[model samples]
Target chain A: MSIITENNDIEDIKIEGEYDGIIELDQWFDPKAENSVLLILNQRIKLDHSAFEALWNSYTIKICADGAANRLFDYYRDSDGKRYHPDVIAGDMDSIREDVLEYYEAIETTTVIKQNTQYSTDFTKSVNVATLLLLGIDLNAVEINEYDGIHKLYQQADKSQLKDIPLLILNGIDGRFDHTIHSMVQFYALRRQDPYFKMCFLTMSDMIILIPSSKKGYWLKLDKVKPLIGNCGLLPLAGPNIITKTKGLKWDVEDWPTSIESGNVSSSNRFVGENCLIACEESIVMSVELKWDKITQHLIDESE
Target chain B: MSIITENNDIEDIKIEGEYDGIIELDQWFDPKAENSVLLILNQRIKLDHSAFEALWNSYTIKICADGAANRLFDYYRDSDGKRYHPDVIAGDMDSIREDVLEYYEAIETTTVIKQNTQYSTDFTKSVNVATLLLLGIDLNAVEINEYDGIHKLYQQADKSQLKDIPLLILNGIDGRFDHTIHSMVQFYALRRQDPYFKMCFLTMSDMIILIPSSKKGYWLKLDKVKPLIGNCGLLPLAGPNIITKTKGLKWDVEDWPTSIESGNVSSSNRFVGENCLIACEESIVMSVELKWDKITQHLIDESE
Candidate 1:
C-alpha cells in the first residue's frame, strides 16, 4: 500500500486523510518510530493531552524543553490525574515551577539544569537533546557538568553520539510573536547544522516544514482531499528570491519572484484544485492546512 | 524641562504622582486636536463614544477601517438610539453589516467601496485618508476609479499630490498574528514610500511608533518619566544591519546588528536612571508604555 493509505507504518500514520498532495501531519504520530523525537514545552498548556498520549504511546524518548515539563505534568494531571514524565527535562530552570521540580525529581525524571544562558532559548536545549538522541548515544554515557549552563550542555550534545531521527515540534508557532520567530530561527539553524534531522512544526491550524530542494528536478504527488485541511501556502521567507512554482491549488503562479521588502510577495493565494505541488530552488518553509477533525479521528483510530 | 513635563499649552490640569518614565499624554493635548479612527473586528470590541468624542473635538476628519463602522453604528444605535455618522468608511466589506452600511449612507458618510484587493488592509486605507487630509487634497477631487485594488491604490497614493502628516494608528498590533504582521508590513512600506508621513500605533498598554534615524546621528532627551509609559524596546525589524547605542537604558548595547534572522534582538530592556538617549544608525520601531488612567483623566478634565 502507498504511504498515504498505510496507517500502520509511522510514515503512513503521518499521511492519513482523503486528500493527499502533501500530508501536513497535523495529527499525532506514533512516537515509537526509530526516526522520531517527542518534545513538550511549557507554552503548550492548552494542548490536547489525549493527542499527546497517542504521540507518547508511539514515541519512547521524550525531551521536555525547560518549563515544558510543568505543562506536561499539569496537562496530564488535569486530564487523568496521572504524572506524565519526560525522559529528559532540560533548560535554564528559572520559570520551571518549584512543585514540578520536586515531583519530577521524585519520579526520576532526569533533570539537566542549564542556567544563565540567554544565547539560546529553552527550546534550543531540548532541540540539542533530540539531535543527540538522533546520533544513537546511550543516555547514560552523556555526563553533564556543574557550572555549565545551556551553552555547555549544547556543546556536550554536539560532541555526544549519533542517529538520524525526525523531530516534530508541537505548539511552537501558536505563541508570542518573538517566541515564534525564535523557533523559526532555530528551524533554519537546524537545517544549516544537519540535513538528516528533518523537522516539522505542527501548529493548531497548519503544519510548517522546510523542504530543501536543489537545482535538480523533483516532483510531489497529490492523492486525495484531506478534510478540515482546506487552505495551504508556500512562501520563501528566508531570503530575497523569486519562487518558480510548478502547480498548486487556486492561484498557481509560474516563476513567481516573491520578496516583500523588494516588492513582489504572493500573499492571500487560495488552494482550490486537488493536489498542490510547489518546487523551490532553495529551502522554503511551506505552511499546509491541517484538518483538525481528521487529525483527532486519526489519533482516535491509532489509540484504538 | 522635557516636552513631557513642561506642558500646559492648555491649562487648569493637575499633575499628580511621579512617573517612572512612562509618558502619560492625557492632560497635555486638548480634546479638539485630532480625529478618531475606530477598529472593531473579530473579538475585539474596544471603543466608547465619549472617548471618541474627545478625539473628534480635536481631529478635523474621521475614517473607519471596514467593520469598525459596523461597531460604531451598533454602539450608537444600541446606546440612546443615536446614529452618529463618520466622515468616511473604507474596507473590503467582508465583515461589514448591511444595517450599518445603510445607516452610514443615510447619515451621509462617504462610503469607499474597495473589493478584490489584497495589497493594503483597512488600517492602510484609513492612513491614506489621513495623508490626503494632511496634504490639503479635496477627497472629492480624486477619481474613485483611479484607485483600482489596494495594491494599485498604494501605487496611486505614492503619486498623488500628498502632504506629510503624523498619523495616530489605534489598536494595530494587539490583534491576530497575520493582522499584526500586515500592520508591520504597512509600517515598513509607508516608511519606504514617504519620509514625512509619521505613524504612531496606540495599543492598550503601550504607544509604538517607528523613528527613522539618520546615518550620522539623532538625539532624544529623557527628562520626565511619563507614568504608565514605563518600559520601551527598540526593534530593528527592517532587513538591514544597524548599529545602535543608548545612554539611558539599564543594559545598553552599542552597534547591535539587530535582525530577525540573526536573533540578536533587544527585548525587555529597562529605562535606567532618567534622561536616557538612543542613537540608531537606521530606522527602528520604538514601543513606549501607555497610561489609560491619564487618558480618562484628560477626558474628564476636558469636560470640566
Candidate 2:
C-alpha cells in the first residue's frame, strides 16, 4: 500500500527485498509542488522576507494560528510595501491584536474564524479550516460550531473523496518542548483519525515527518532531499518499534531492537544515498536537519 | 513512593482522598538548596551573568556534553575574565572544538571522558559520570571502558545507595525539535531504568518534568512555582494515559482520557494554585512555561 500520491518522477529505488508501503517524504513537501496548505503557527518563523514571500506565494491556501496573523503582517510585505495576509485566521482570539484582525477583515478574500474553544488548540482549528477548505467545503455552507468545528464538518463531508492533503507547518515544532512534543503526538493522533492530512513540520533547524505504523513498513524516496539535509534520525514517537531492516543510512541496522522504554534509538543517522527503507513493527518519526543555506539558495535561484 | 528528597520546607499538601506517590516539582531544583548536577547541553542557556552565576554556584558538580564545553567556555567568564570550565566533559567528540577541549583538559580538575561509542548520547554519558560521581565512586576507582562506561561503572558500584540526584540541564530542550523530544524520551526511559536521577529541564522558555508511570500517580507541589510560571501543559510523551483526575489546574479535568495515538491531551493549563494532583494510568510529561522576567527579577533581588 503506497501512501505516495502517484508521484514517481524518480526511478524506482532498488531494494534487495520486498517492502510494504511507499512514503515519498521529500517529494511531498517540495517547494516547487506548491500543493501544501501553509499554516503559520508562530511569529518565530526565521525565514527572510524573500524566503517567506516565496513560501507564502507557493502554497494554495494559507492559514494562521491566531497571533501568527500578526507575525505574517510583520514578517513579509509586497514590493508595494503592503503586508501579506493569510486566507483565513483561526483561533480563540486571545493573542491576536485587534488592529491586525481588522486589517485582515477589511480584505474581502480573508476570512477570520474566531473559534473560542479551549477543547482544541489554534493549530488544530487551523488544520480543521485547511482540511475543510481543501475538501472544497465552503465555510459559509458548512454547519460550523464555535467549538470543535471538525466534528460537524466531518459529518457533512464526503469521506470517500478525502485524499491526502499536504500541510507545511511553520514554527509548529518550536516554542515549548512539551508543545513541540505535543505537536508530534497531535499529528500521530490526527493522522490516525483523518488519514487525508499529511503533516510536514518545517523549522529553521530541521524538518520532521511522523511516519505512522504500517504492517508493510515504508520505503522512503530521498533522492531529491539527500543533499538538502544534514544528520537524520529514525525515532520512536508514540511507542517502541522492532526495526527489522533498513537501507541507505550511514549506519544501517538490521533486526535492531528499538524501545522508548529502554532508551535505545537510531539518532543522528545520516542519509548516505537517494533512497531508504524502514521495516518497523510500529510507528516511528523520521527527522532530517535542514541545510538552511542550501534551501535559501535554492529559493533564491527559483525567484531568478 | 515519595520521589521528593527529605527536604520538606512547606506544609504537606492535604488531598481529600488518598494518593500513591509524591512528586515535588517546584522544590526539587530549589536554587537556595543548591544541590544539583548542572549540565550545559548547548550555548543557548539564556541566563544572564548573575543568573548563570547563581545557577552555576548552586550545583555541586557540573558537566558539559561535547561541543557544549565550548559554549561554557564562551558564555561565562569570571570577574578575572577567566573562562568557566566544567568538572567533566563527555561525548562522541565530533563537535567539540580542539582549543576548547584543550582548555578544559589543561585544568587538573576537569576530566574529559572521550567515549567514541554512539550507542549512548553524550547527554547519557554525562549522566553516567554524574551518577557515578554522585554515588561517591571516583572515575579513577571505577573499571571504566572507553565505550559504554556506564555498563562497567554500574557493575563496580553499589546500586542500592544511589539516591535521587537532581540534574539542572540548560540548552537541553532547545535547538532541534527531535533532539528536544529525544531528550524527553531519554529522561522517561532513563528514569524508569534508574529512578534516582530526578530530571528538571530548565530552558529559557519552560521547565519539563518527565513523570514516570506510578501505581499511585503523582502529587506535584506547585506552591513555589505558582508565581514563576505563565501556562502549563500535561502532555503525553511516550504513549497514551487515561488521566483519571487532576487538581490545581485552571481548567481541571476528571476521568479525562489522554492518547498520543489519538492526540487527546491537556495543554496550556494554568496554575490555579500552589499544589496539583494528577492521577494517570500511564507515563505523562508535564511542563510549565517559565516567567523569565519574574525569574530574572528574583535573581536580581537575590544578587542584591
lDDT of 2: 0.72
Tens digit of lDDT per residue, candidate 2, span B41-79? 965556877777766766788999989988888777768
lDDT of 1 at B130: 57
> Lowest summed lDDT over 10 consecutive residues: which window, candidate 1 chain A?
A1-10
lDDT of 2 at A5: 21
The sequence of per-residue lDDT tens digits that candidate 2 reaches over residues A225-258 is 6677787777776666777667667666766776
**What is the lDDT of every predicted structure here?**
0.55, 0.72
Off by over 4 Å in 2: A1-21, A28-34, A137-154, A253-257, A302-304, B1-21, B28-34, B137-151, B253-256, B300-304
How many residue-pair clashes does candidate 2 contain? 0
TM agreement with the true structure for every prediction: 0.71, 0.87
